[model samples]
Target: MTDDDRGTRRGEIGPTERLAMNRTGSFDWDLDTGTIDVDEAGLLVFGMGAGAFDGRPATLVQALAPEDRADLDAVIRHAIITGQTSYTAHFRVDMEDGTPQWTHVQARILRKPDGMAHRIVGIVRDTTAEVTHSDFVLELERRREVQTSIVERTTHALSRAVTVDDVTAALTGPGGLARLGADGLALGLVENGSLNLIALSGESLEILDDFRSRRLDRGLPLAEAVLSGRPRFVPAFPALGRDFPELAPYVARMRFRAACYLPLVAQARSLGGMALFYRGRTAFSADERNLALGLAAIVAQSLQRALLFDEERALATGLQETMLPRRIPEITGGEIAVRYHAAWSGRQVGGDWYDVIPLPRGRVGIVVGDVQGHDTHAAAIMGQLRIALRAYAGEGHAPSTVLARASRFLAELDTNRFATCTYAQVDLSGGTVRAVRAGHLDPLIRHTDGRVGRPKLRGGLPLGLATVFGEEEFPETRLDLVPGETLVLHTDGLVEQPGADIEAGLAALADAVRTGPPQAEALADHLSERLWERWGAEDDVALLVLRRSPDPGTPRAPRIHQYIHQADPQGLSDARAAVGQALRDWDMDDLADDAELLTGELLVNVLLHTEGGAVLTLEVLPEPVRRVRLSVQDRSSAWPRRRTPGEAATSGRGLLLLDALSSRWGVEPRGEGKAVWCEIGPVPTPAGAPST
Candidate 1:
């Protein structure tokens, strides 16, 4: 065909058909009637003769290489049998020089109405360079998969470790290290200008340490690779055999003919290097080098995290030691024991503290308090408050008064912090304890008889309330403690904790004391253990136990006397005789009858109005006072009212009799049982008022 005919045929086709004809430079083929159509680029690619040739029409199989002829035939046959319009394939074609070149063939079959293909029109393009480039990319991708698998397996095994030793064992143990295809491996950490042997896979620690202790020159293969921020592999040691003879023994012992050293870099900092040894003289592929670097990075990060944790624990422990009080003072007439326990195995240093201050008049002030946070600031605030409270108590103030002053001091101090505190003063001489509570746990009093009692006291607001001019009313409460009674004061951290109800914790503490040993040390230890067991030790705890000393003057099982009398004067005389006989029966012959006359007058008033006679009960309690209470009940639905002496007639003489004979008196209503009580002080006798 002429060039004009070819141009006309190409113009009649679509844009895709026109471009397909123009891109035929990489192939040689016959067009139309078996005439060779060879462009200049196509002639250069095939290196074949370029002349018009007269021959039969060339079939699609004519361009296929000898080895790919069968595949090309199969594709053509399928297209013809299925009446497919076209078939395409990638195959190699034999060139004129007997060399093979890759080619892509696309064949179009033309069929008649008889279902038989008579003509096959196709295009062939050489793709030798493209196919070679594509095969290289596929090979690299497969190698990447192998490298990723190795890194994933190693990291998964290492993450299961709970301790540093476990991590090292997992990284260096036989199965774990061999899986990475290293004949022997050494982990070196940068220390003192030389690599310190942290771990090794197939070498003794002594050998590794000795080798690492030698000065690692910066230009050494492993050291240079780390410093240059790239991996280096020594394919053979023969090149450096003469320069570094000392490495010959290590190389032979480790069976390493080839070695790859990778730097452990994390966050732009070089930690050390990991040396992977190979038994054969084999070089690492790019994928193997990447895997080595990735594993080294993971090791560096994990080691850094462990070191940081240890440093944090050291700091927390040091802060706790400085925060807690070093010693507590020895109290006179009382045995004081204190125990402070910080929470176990955590970084929090809580703000629980206790203090004991000696006050004037043979009294000791005790305090247990907790600030509102769990850090250094909380602890510092606790110390400041403790010092301020002690200073106030030392100034001869009552327990309630001391707390009020301390609250004001905290409110006006530099810090606007608040604290819950329990302040108590034990009067050794009087056998009484006065206390004030400021939003704190109530201290428990364990009697010598094994009975526990919580003293009645109204709790005030915590410190720092005075900033708003909010007055903190500290209710002063007094309790007469018997000899051998024990008092326990503690912060809420001792009994209150996370995941535990406060009431349950309190009950647990009480049960521990009830069932455990009785000594102060034993009791504190048992209660602390019970608390930690239930609550898991989430906060700091402080405890103080005070055991009251036995008093020599206290009576044991003193006698009690009751007298009932009518309203008549004869009954009053009879009441006087009952009092004298009771005192004498208790071995007290020094009793005077004048004190009994005052008691009889108060009882006669109740008998005159009520259907039942009056009841007068007297008992000797512990130290300082012998109590005598007179209860007068009447059926009248009227309450007692105090009256002026000038306004009332002779009927007011009953109250005057109570006021004259009793040290204190009060009236209280008890569910239709109204009682007017009169307490008489111990009378002065020759033998120190019968020892009260």
Candidate 2:
């Protein structure tokens, strides 16, 4: 090489060599001659014999593995041609023993004074162990961070899951298995000590479905995990051929060589197992195993909680249904409809009941009551109270008498819970109603024209507080139901919301009832839906509606109509029943006993003094004159006559008894028979009746 080409910078090569002498190796390359000179350590790093390498650039390049030779040569040529300051590269070289060793090379060009390319001076170091260790650590850290994030997100999802299906989706959905690097997932719950596959993801579903149908016991990774309460890891699919040869096709189709079965254990109890699949054999790290175990624990706990809630809610629903009446009494002259809405709190039962009892003499008893509690105990008490009320009312007691007796019955039981109730007796024939309240909301009356009114009732103490006394009796309120008017009785749950004005809810309820559909059924349904949509009160609600419409032939709302036959002495009984029914329909059930007596007297006179069967007809006069007219016709020309009974004269005093019991009595002679008629009063003096 020429002097200038030798380079003044190259004169300091001795100092550069001394600096690169320890640990690392040093080398010099003449670009013009394409010759290389390496120290002993440099030759060792390049995988060349101590004195075997000639001073040739090709020889040095040939020592490096083929994969790295071209890139290293290009870097060296560029540095020399452009007089680049420095360049570094890592490459591999094959040792004499055929073992590959990794090396790092750093080169700097020694330029001439004219700034032309001259010689290249460089150092070489063996970094095979350090590079391999660093890459392995970095990869492990990346995997750990990824798995930690996935586990955290999965736990959050599981926490929000409130049902079994939600739990399954969180464990096997796209957000779950994919993040965990699983190819397919199968979740098997340990129910009744058996592993039953409930959810699956990816291609494993078909295989898992077949496996579940087989009902195999033992020899399965999932079963083993659940039975042992530990995780089972299968490193390779072929390794399972001996134990589970049936899974070969599944493994092949899913391209699965590795799998993990983890038991979902919580509080030391094994609830289920989770199966994870991978495309190739995987050596699970301790971190991965621990992460999976934690995930299983969270899933197990969430599933257990959701399952328990479902069971409790079902039980509560059953109890509540049994406590409420299934059907209302089918009566005439009016229509009765009932509705019940349950509380929203899970597994919590409320004490709300509605009943319709058809009593003797055609009087109907309607009750809406609420027992204080939010559990099974309340439901039980409500059922008992409902039965007691029905029994008392059916025994021919008046509305106030029935409620007072019910209150006494509750007090005798000494149950800590109290109850509010409203009892109403509707007289279909009399067109009158009597209601008594025991610490309950007053009944609402909705007129056909959309006006609503609630009477100012005096409330008594709630049942279970004390025995009913003369002064403490539930105060009675009487109403003359106008045609097309409805009486609404509801439990407090319908109008009471938590931390809100109760009066507002009551006004809303009254408005809904007044403006609802005219038909009883449609009105009841509409009011219930309105309550649910407006406040969604979390308490149970019970509504009972009784509507009295205009005359039957006018095409108004639904009403009841019944007929009975009259024959001999049975005819007298039938006559009483017919009048009683009419009286009850008219809401004058209080006058049923007297009316029945008058009808019985007339029917008996026909059966005893006349020759043929009698036909009894009972009818009601609406609004302006609320009266029940009872008439019995017999095929006899003899008309009834008033006679003064001689104490022992049971046969001749029929007309006298009818005259004394009824507001009006008369006998009209027909062509073939004589008709005896008696009429009961238009109850509640006209001056006392509410204005339309």
Candidate 3:
């Protein structure tokens, strides 16, 4: 039928009936006989006369080709005997021109109300073109699925890669080119007008060198193919014998006949190219080319990311080295070993640091501090605080005084940063340590006999708080160490970790000390190993170990005496008698005159200030230095202020005389009274026979 006649017939049919006929191609049939009553296209398709052949044993076998007649006859017989709804078969039909055409036929058995057998009404259509088209579409779909899988796998491989070498290796690896049915592959990087062999698969280095030595121009098959920013397929290398004679011999040896060159371009930068080689003269289809180019783009991006990450790692390494202390100081008499461990992984650099400062009066100050954050800023702040702590300790200040000055300096610092630190001064001769804590973890002191103690001291507020001065006290804690005793100072980063209690870390440290390594280096190594084992330290860890040596001489205690002044004459006599008693007790009677003069000035101050009763007190103690402290107690709470030479005050003259005669003097508030104290130095030995 004409196309317009078919369209008009389709339009005349009702929408629902037309849709049903189009789907099933149903038609009327004769009841009580197996015969088709009407089939619009049956005469043209079957080359049969257009008349009903009722009760004549009509069957589809008449229209079917001889080779399919048996199968169609069997299907129709089964449907007729069992009253089955339908039967289907594929058959070839002999048309009017004696041409055989493949057709798909479906028949249904219909029944009348009286249960009489009805004709088999069916539809048949020529299926040769449809079947061929279906097969072609399926083949296309299979190729599409293969290409999609290849692209997905290649993209995944590229994403996993983290460096240029990684990208090159992945691109040229067994799975990469082999997935595309390639026998060999080569990856090149563009450099100095030549393609350098960055990577290769299934090829020797010598072969690659020989291939690259041809010095092919940029517009040649390989370079031009990639430089065009498109994938190019070389069907056969033998066909290019005239154009590339040098490659012909090698191509024969390698048994490579075809190749595909894919460019690696990203962000408008042409980095390099990849070549896939095959054994036969096979050219990739359009889909294969697109897949290869897509994979190349992924490889390029992965390589760039890897290079950037490498650069960042190098920069971080340099920054970390510069932030840490270059060298530790050399201390005399005692060995000082310090260990600083930086975090090996992650983006942060530690701010933990330690310093061993030499203080005046033969004492060494030990400091361990941690800035709050872990970054470049924290490292910079640590450096500033370390230098400031050393400078403050060098000024002959006690541990508390040094911490106080450091706190003030850090608080007033323009950066307005904060840090936690512990400062201690060790007197090598006496094994006496004076320490101050500023919101820092308490250091552990392990005695020689396996006793561990954290000294009792009030922790000062951290620096940078506005009200820190009032809330925090740099209380000094003194520790007396015997031979083989060790003091461990560390930052919290060593002990504090996620998912673990801090007490566990402390217990671990204590157990480590109990294992017993007496040397400073040995002890430091032990502690460092143990800390690393348990805490898996996140921040940098800094440790300082100080051990005391055995004392060579016996301990000796000197006598200290103090006498305060009173208003009465009896008070003056009482002060003199107390001074005499102190010297006699310590067997230092030769300095009686010096003690008497010091007492006179102190007593006169009480007499001048008090109108009534005043008190005088004396204290004697054995503490190496024979200290004579005199306290003249009065009800007045006022302290004596220093007076300049021109500023005249008759009462302040006693302080001047007291300052001149005594070794040390100061005023401190006593219960209900203020005490002015003075101490006298020991008497000089005659000719230095053995200093008493």
Best by TM-score: 2
Question: Order the candidates by lDDT, highest first — what do you get?
Answer: 2, 3, 1
Q: Score every model by TM-score.
A: 0.47, 0.53, 0.49
Off by over 4 Å in 3: 1-84, 89-103, 110-128, 145-263, 270-281, 328-377, 390-403, 421-459, 466-692
Task: Indicate whether candidate 1 or candidate 2 has the larger TM-score.
Answer: 2
lDDT digits (tens) for residues 93-208 of candidate 2:
77788887788998887778998877889888988788789889999989888888877787787887766877887777766776656777888876665677888887645756
- What local distance difference test score does each model get? 0.66, 0.74, 0.67
RMSD of each: 14.6, 17.1, 16.9
Instruction: Show pairs that collide, candidate 3.
Output: 560-620, 561-628, 561-629, 562-618, 562-629, 563-630, 564-631
Model 1 pairs whose backbones collide:
none
Weakest 10 consecutive residues of candidate 3 by summed lDDT: 553-562
Q: Is candidate 2 or candidate 3 better by lDDT?
A: 2
For residues 165-186, what per-residue lDDT tens digits would candidate 1 score against the true structure? Answer: 5567777875876556667777
